[model samples]
Target: MPLALYLLALAVFAMGTSEFMLAGLVPDIASDLDVSVGTAGALTSAYAIGMIVGAPLVAAFARNWPTRTSLLSFILAFAAAHAVGALTPDFPVLFATRVVAALANAGFLAVTLTTAATLVSPDRKGRALAVLLSGTTTATVAGVPGGAVFGTLFGWRATFWTVAALCLPAALGVLKGISAGLVQEHAADGPASHTELATDGPALRTELAQLARPRLILVMLLGALVNAATFAGFTFLAPVVTDAAGLGELWVPVALVLFGVGAFTGVTVAGRLSDRHPGPVIAVAGPLLLIGWPALALLAAEPVALLTLVFVQGALSFALGSTLITRVLYEAAGAPTMAGSYATTALNMGAAVGPLLAATTLGTAAGTLGPLWSSGLLIAAALLIALPLRTTISTGRGIEVPR
Candidate 1:
């Protein structure tokens, strides 16, 4: 891949951390802001809702603007929102900032994914996506846990400030690294059909229309199911390790790190092979996760089994998740510049839905392990969704995937 891709990934790490970093800081925020903990927790939901709704809207709005112009604008907005969030006193003001930050994150991330596709040759799109997603996985390991620690040492505001600070360089790097021709949709080599609509400044309806493809819908649905499996289990991982497994507080981060490390491995491996072998990757990981989550539900009390399964499931979940996101990009090949927004929507839809399902399961008989059972059911659903694809893509080599 290119240096631009790495720069984008760096920016993504910061944004991804904020998506869940607030989970650790909720109590402090509730105390400082003089609100109940439940109210403070709504900020994360605000971010998730913004991500789901803003992606397509922002993509369509910026569809007419120069790519570099839009990208830089979103990056600056993200940084400024965080800065404002850090400095804000009123809870409502901070809530607004979170929404703005998420909108900015959505826009910039959508553009970056399509930008990555435009930067690489067709055979390497999977690798490019892997590189991008690895940033998110890394955030799960380092950025989030580290942010929690940082907030504990300093204050939650300091973590917000740090994210804001990181965005400045990322914006500058993206400004320098992006091709001028790319921003103008005049690539030197060939048609830019995949990057933009056939006409200049296409209407929002036109961009939205691209999402109507049957195959694209199925691919995106599959993506959502995969993510639902991940987030449903992960949103409660700390509690699962501590409350259910009877591990100490120290083991929470260890479990998260194990999962995050496995995710790194999964994304790395998927990037190298997904373009040519997505079918096999999905086929293997899907079944393993179906078995793994239930086994986790049954064996959480066993420290050795619990830790080992967390690592293994993390790897398998991300491996399949990476492949599915890549598939969404390819399946939406006709989406012009809107393909990345489609990917974002599918990705965050799971982020929103998974937790809702898991939260409901919490008060039931399953308690902490309810999320694991939910995750297992999601995996089964995902496998069922892919069942039809098996016949169509019997050999992994046949799909016309990303570059």
Candidate 2:
């Protein structure tokens, strides 16, 4: 609800656009760089791998830095990486830039989430996080499609330049907004200026120990499995829509837009509900996916049914994702940034794994329908892993369990 929170969202929008726009540019990049489509596609994997490996490392290294300082540094690095990417003449340079961009993106997201949580009251943390994450959903709705259109009209390099141009304003906004917010807080609190910020040494060690607990590990696993469930079906949505659902190639964009709308709606709903009843929201969302996927597989040939199911499935999947993120933040209270970094790491791992699983399934006799079923099973497993959180909350031990 603060201006700085919205500014953070703007920064996220810039990063998310760069991250997702690669999907649309793969063909152009492959042709331009004289490589196979699959090789150019490896750029996406490089970014994910960078996020998975870079998040924890960046979090640890920035442990002693002020929140605003870390955020500004990361955003600037991300902008510079995009600038390099826009001018690169070969695939190797482009791939290296992707890795650097992802590293900066990971650090920016982790710090931003932690900073957003500190800006609000404990009771409103979930809603604040949802507001921050809405940038990614918004990117899916507008940025990716806009980039694709731009790339189609101009060239792929032009799209990268556009992304680089967007990042400059976001970085400047973050610099101005966070500085003002911190200065205002300092004026209000006097000598207790660092109260809302993370400390180093002993505190860091304790938070690391807390992060390693079995219950928290389960929570991280749940986050990963839930993501796997969503991406397993989503990564191959084009084929599923055309081959399995018997829809035309033209319908794929329509289905994607519907899914994006649903995702935006879901995040909005989760923002309101998660602050009050995260457990129940996640409980319902997982089951919705569990039920929706099988029905999707069965009714793929029905155009009307497939359209409706895709929207609902997207809504449920994102709703569950936002709730899981909030839960991880709650469970890892002392080290919010590191917790967020770990959550991002888990989600990236799942993003990588889900596509592989879906691709393998496509190669089997089950074909496209296999991904839908596989997603359902993964969600079911995630639900089972989530059971302990419900039990902890019901027993009024949620606060104690994390410590």
Scored by CA lDDT, what does every candidate get? 0.85, 0.78
Residue 337 lDDT, candidate 2, scale 0-100? 49
lDDT of 2 by residue, 64-138 (tens): 677778888998888888888888888999999999999998888777776776676656667888888788878
Give candidate 2 misplaced runs (Cα > 4 Å): 180-202, 393-403
For residue 225, model 2's alpha carbon misses the true position, in angstroms, by 0.7
Tell me the TM-score of each prediction against the true structure. Answer: 0.93, 0.92
Question: Whole-model lDDT for model 1 versus the true structure?
Answer: 0.85
Structural RMSD, model 2: 3.3
Q: Where does candidate 2 clash, by residue pair?
A: none
Scored by lDDT, model 2 comes in at 0.78
| Residue pair clashes in candidate 1 | 122-403, 123-403, 124-403, 125-403
Indicate the worst ten consecutive residues by lDDT in candidate 1. Answer: 394-403
